[model samples]
Target: MKFVQPIRDKRKIEAMKKVLKSESVRDYALFVLGINSGLRISDLLALSVDDVTTETGNIKERITLKENKTGKTKDFPIGTSAHKALKEYLDTSSLETTSPLFLSRKGTKAIRREQAYRILNNAARTVGIKDKIGTHTLRKTFAYHAYKSGYDLSMIQKLLNHSAPSVTLRYIGITQEEMDDVYLTLNL
Candidate 1:
């Protein structure tokens, strides 16, 4: 298996959002929620309309689910960006409460992992991102941006459920140059 890098540039992320949004609202929601929640592709794809919305159809404040990979229950607050994207998608689609949030074109099930990968990869390419992107790029992008925004590494480690700081750093594609800059810039 090949390693994939995070979408490291903010402008590129926006460009990707634009491209995906223009293509399909469901695809846009998938990308937005993926990056915002950092959920694995499996877990994200497994979500249903009820998972993210109330019976009255309002977006929920938090999402709680058991991760497929870790088998651990995760509960996270929905961020404004994700919530907005989801609301937009739900408004446009005729999804029932039990319908898959990221439904397939046939409306029978959620889009497959491969399809999710294609959606993200094509959008990345459209945005001129040359990085090796896959479904995991959403998770890595969330972590990379969180770190860049001054979130503690330990907090990020916990969010990702990683066993160690080193693992989190490596998984998020933190480079030696970034580490060196920490030392160089902290000349206090």
Candidate 2:
């Protein structure tokens, strides 16, 4: 499997977001929720409307689920951007409580992982992102920005369900030069 990198350029991130949003609210919400929640594509694709919605059809502030790969439960708060996009999508889409959150064009079931990859790749290409973007890019982007924002490394490791901090470090694509810069800058 070819390695995919996180979107480190803020401009490209914003551009991709814009492209997805302009394309469809469903697409926008999918990307926003993925990057914000750090969920694997399988987990995200498996979500039903009830998973993120209340009985009254309001978006939940936090969502919880058992991960498909790890069999461990994880809960995360939806970020503002993701929340807004989700609300917009919910309002416009003819989705029921049990319907797949990200349905395919036929609306019979959740989209396949391959289709999700195509959507992400097309959006990335539209925004002129030259990186090797793929479904994992969303998860890596979440961890990369979280660590860059000074979020706890242990917390990120747990979120990604990695066995160690070192694995999380490498998963987020941290470079030795960047680590060295952090050491030099933290002169306290």
Residue 187 shift from truth in candidate 2, angstroms: 6.3
- Clashes (backbone N, CA, C under 3 Å), per candidate, total 0, 0
Could you tell me how far off, in angstroms, the CA of residue 130 lies in candidate 1 after the best superposition?
0.4
For candidate 2, give the lDDT.
0.91
- Report the poorest 10 consecutive residues by lDDT, candidate 2: 103-112
What local distance difference test score does each model get? 0.95, 0.91
Give stretches of model 1 more than 4 Å off: none
Clashing pairs in model 1, backbone N/Cα/C closer than 3 A? none
Candidate 2 C-alpha error for residue 131, in Å:
1.3
Tens-digit lDDT string for candidate 2 (137-186) = 99999999999999999999988989999999999999999989988999
Error of 1 at 155 (Å): 0.6
lDDT by residue for model 1 over 1-188, one digit each (tens)? 57999999999999999999999999999999999999999999999999999988899999999999999999999999999999999999999899898999975899999999999999999989998999999999999999989999999999999999999999999999989998999989
| Residue 114's lDDT in candidate 1 | 93
- With a 3 Å backbone cut-off (N, CA, C), the pairs that clash in candidate 2 are none
CA RMSD per model (angstroms): 0.8, 1.4
Worst 10 residues of 1 by lDDT: 99-108
**C-alpha displacement of 175 in model 2, angstroms?**
1.0
